[model samples]
Target: MPIEWIDCKPISLVWFSWREPLLYVLFTPWLLSLFAGLLITALTVVLSIRLSWLNRSLIVISAVLSVNIIYSPLATQWLSVWLSSQLPQTFERAEDAPRPVAVLLGRGAKIGRATSRKAAQLLNDHKVEAVYVSGDRLSTAQRVVKLGAPAERVAGDSCARTTWQNATRTNAWLQRNHPEAPVLLITDPWQLPRAAHAFAGQGLKVMPMAISPQLNSRTRNRLALRETAGTLLYRLQGRM
Candidate 1:
């Protein structure tokens, strides 16, 4: 269901959203915290010797407690909202002066296809000269052509999985091909803040055409905790 259609209550929806990947992404920190907590409990027992078995027994208890404890500030609040808030956004086609190059960042083919359709709406009103689709649509090139953009106008970047790279790559392509054209930056709103930063930093005069939304304080606050935990973990592992 569209997020705008219903105000989401976490309690009613979390169980229903309990697919493995979502669980893994949201509950990843709980697992790590639990593991660390158990190791600490084990170390304490090792030092005493008298309570070695007791410490081992306490591991499961500590792990469960750790999972539930970390669950409150992080998982339900920030991570869920961070991920789910990036659903598809519908934008009113830019109608004033022409945005000759519409830069659509791709999370997938249908995503690009949907965004491309929006670009076509802009094109119909002569608002943009062409669509710049950034990401791997794979076989969906045919779909892009089907949406009314000429094949040469659809620029694809298969390597970008992050917004920073997307902005950099799209900017490079624009400089080479359509340097003077004003751009329509199309993407989900939750990620837009960082994206706009990166794109504008690249000196693209961006007119944003948002696809989804950034959740409210109720949601962003909840989701932020999860992302904070995740960011910490990523730092520790040198993955960030």
Candidate 2:
């Protein structure tokens, strides 16, 4: 039987997908901030022509402050630290529950490879009974298999495109097959907070395991900011 999903719909339309250019930029951190700042500046500049000096001054100040806050390295750093703090140190095992299955949430080829490696390691160590790749499923699953995870022990679906979808889809699968199995929710450190919350919201037992790729400071800050924005958006949508 096919499971019904709540708070998510399977992708049947291409234009509205999150991967579309507009939505992608809107969700991405640095790009969104830069675009917003430019838009605000342009609008205020045009509006200033009709306004009094004081009003123009106010708009300029507001624009500057908003841009500074969003672009601030300190803000991104602080948000990254706070997000990392929300992750669980270890999985809470239950005597009667089946051994945890690693549910690797894919980001991209780089991070997905890193996460697949971690999942393969867990399977080899017997820390997890099986591995399931969500998000970018096929490529990640192939990587996991190549990493030495037995082909029979790895499974996944390509239906998930977002963290919310990853959780809900995997939860539906778990409910139908391994109802009591704990999930080792694997992803990058910055994304772990929102990803874990999303999985837990769908009533899965989630234990976050971060396997971040090697990124420079600039790239890391961008990802951290993106995750921060994602967390807030999810909260507003009540998905977490």
- Residue-level lDDT of model 2, residues 1-240, one tens digit each, is 211222334577573555467646744556766676677667877866777767766776676567557446787688789888766445578777789989887687788888888899989888888888776747678777787778877877877777887888788778876788889888899999898888888777888777878877666776776787778787798865
The models' CA-based lDDT, in order, is 0.57, 0.76
Looking at model 2, the pairs that clash are none
Model 1: residue 182 alpha-carbon error in angstroms: 2.9
lDDT of 1 by residue, 105-206 (tens): 765444455666676667656667766666544344445556665666555555555555677777887888788676787765444444555576677776
Clashes of each: 9, 0
Model 2, poorest ten-residue lDDT window? 1-10
